[model samples]
Target: MSDGLPMRVPAPGLPARVRIHEVGPRDGLQNEPGTVPTEVKAEFIRRLAGAGLGTVEATSFVHPKWVPQLADAERLYPLVSGLDVRLPVLVPNERGLERALALGAREVAVFASATESFSRANLNRTVDEALAMFEPVVARAKAEGLAVRGYLSMCFGDPWEGPVPLAQVVRVTRRLADLGCDELSLGDTIGVATPGHVTALLTALDEAGLPASRLAVHFHDTYGQALANTLAALQHGVTTVDASAGGLGGCPYAKSATGNLATEDLVWMLHGLGIETGVDLGRLTATSVWMAEELGRPSPSRTVRALSHKE
Candidate 1:
């Protein structure tokens, strides 16, 4: 056995401490064509909480024209507000921020894309313009005593704009950090990132004086590389990760983008590595299976599939 600092050997294992932010309720349902009823969304959140997830992306405050599924943010937030968890809502601009604050959102996430093409597609604005727009929202949210998390989407690659420059990622990250946001999440939006790319990017950030504690990694499993990328980040000392239950969600804008790294799959990897995710893998698996049945699709989590087969 190895001694001190829980190092991941060539063989598989869990990390020492792992924090999973469940995004199934928001990210998982956002891209689906059919609008999931608010009650169903609340039920998903309830199951996740019962499964021991501490942080959940509960909803988005975008207008109905953009993401009609989350138009019921106001309706859903109050229903689950009393839970013992952090419910982070994604706010697109000052209007979104105002709505979140009015509803008493404790924490919020502001998003920016590292690639110009994606920024244009997702936000209908350039990278710089989107950041400029969110500046006041971040300020106002902070003024309202809300915690802000910054999302840097397409950190690794963009469909229209090939590989994103590390410098661009750094610039966006710094901008968010300087704007008084609490944490920054680097998203492998299209799931094109590999282990080496993760290491390179994190290392560059470290070299640039950005500590890992204030950072999280959001990865998609499009190329089936999400777990590998998670391990790479764990080895580099990342403590927090973003995942969805049942491997739900895909980018409506990114044609090739797939669902996020499944929470069950990520928890399986973390538990194997001795990481404490405060999540029950068995319960999470059951939840994913149930969700798949609810969605009328096959479960996307490899770990869930394997466990179900064994039973």
Candidate 2:
């Protein structure tokens, strides 16, 4: 309390360290109404890495027509590529993959949907069709010696489809894993998941031969259950968590989507639980606050607000 830090109480049966997959640059800015300048985005990535986020998603290679906010992926990646961290980019298909590969991206992620409705809405392809599209992208990335991550959105619920079945999620995840994805990020895209749902999904994944080691969790905060679902994931042995700085990003395709779990908030909880993330809390909070100013709004992260106001 004296140092303005949460009292550490190490949680039992939790990983001692969690790798936060910072998604602010790519996922966070994709839905922004205004264009964030390429230099500003490069600076954001620099600040995130300076704050000790080891794995930062630099940008996406999606067509500018689809995500104008990140249209400068070509420019942004070059600016931050020199930073000493793992920089991943999302590739929608072989074209996107080639764009990232041309820029020398070492790690690439492909986005998929666990529900038919989301698949059709987001990718303009059915669930099976979308997977077919990503098949070669993942294969090409792996063949090039690049690490591939599969992002499975709507694993918990879909805006159009309501509750997604456990079996449906497992099937998609298994196929992604089978397609040479090094890791799979299970996304509660609409922020509708609870602790119990998280537990059941993880258990099913485990039973289906997809262990927690190759899994990550991405939760939105539409219902304020992001942290609780995250805690459940930690208890279940999933170490990688996808978070956006300052609680940024929402699904532009999903009508009910909201901001993601903020990096500051997730860092606060992890540090409070005595889990090592290697992130400098003060520096990370400052980074978020700086980013909020760039975006012309206050940070939605409770921890960012609390810590910044305390100063």
Candidate 3:
């Protein structure tokens, strides 16, 4: 846990606390068409931390040509370095990793796709070729004492190749674990995953020796199944979940992909279920409202919409 936040002991059926890995700042803003000023981005991250999100993904170190929105990674990291939260940046390759380390980043995440079509489209390489690229990145980060997170995109279905096979997902997940990823985040990139798919994939991973504790679920709300898929993961003992504040992200590579599961929505459900998340829902909703103003739009979060009316 970042900043030594106390973790609750999970009960028999459900985890007492679920660590919400907030990715709004990085994954959320990366797909925006217009530029968000560096100062505004910094303040947004500060507000997220203030709302008690301990593990917030601050920015991506990908080259400016690929993700121009996060081109200020060097400038942005220093601004939030003093915060008592786990600020993880995304590193796509060794060069990306070098940039992050230069900024004194303590944790970084690498992404790969499960299908060849998406890999070719997103990373400009085949699935095997991308993993070959990530191998050294993960190994080097681990050697440098930085926590490394592995992201497997399109774990359930792909836009180009529909209905990805279960075997392929498990194979890629196990390979990431073998390559020394501290944790693997399974992504439903197009939001096509149902609860049954979530349960089966998780069960397959466990059978392959990659336990649920080493996994996190990243779901998109395109088909309105993000929350339901998340529930399936929770029932199967997955404790880490990836969500965006105000439902702020979409996939640039996969145009059909939509916003991520809203942080406010996830927190509301956890609180109702008597699960501990250490997040202040009122504060989270306020932050979302503030960010919506910055983006010049209303937040996509249902919880934010409903709560803003009361406020």
Instruction: Kindly list the per-residue Cα lDDT of model 2 for residues 1-311, writing each as its tens digit.
Output: 65557999997899999999999988899889999999999999999999999999998899989888888999889898999999999999999998899988999999999999889888999989999999889988999999999999999988887899999999999999999999999999989999999999999999999999999999999999999999999999999999999999988777677799999999989999999999998998999999999889999999999999988
Q: Report residue 278 deviation for candidate 1 (angstroms).
A: 0.7
Best by TM-score: 2
Per-residue CA lDDT of candidate 1, range 91-162, in tens?
A: 999999889888889999998999889899999999889989989999988888899999999999999889
- Model 3 residue pairs with clashes: none
lDDT of 3 by residue, 168-279 (tens): 9999988888899999999999999999999999999999999999999999999999999998999999999999999999888778777999999998888767788889
| TM-score to native of every candidate shown | 0.94, 0.98, 0.96
Each model's lDDT: 0.88, 0.93, 0.92
- Each candidate's number of clashing pairs is 7, 0, 0
User: In model 2, which runs have C-alpha deviations exceeding 4 angstroms?
Assistant: none
Model 3 TM-score is: 0.96
Worst 10 residues of 2 by lDDT: 1-10
Model 1 pairs whose backbones collide: 13-272, 13-273, 14-272, 14-273, 14-274, 15-273, 15-275
Better of 2 and 3 by TM-score: 2
What's the alpha carbon RMSD for model 2? Answer: 0.8
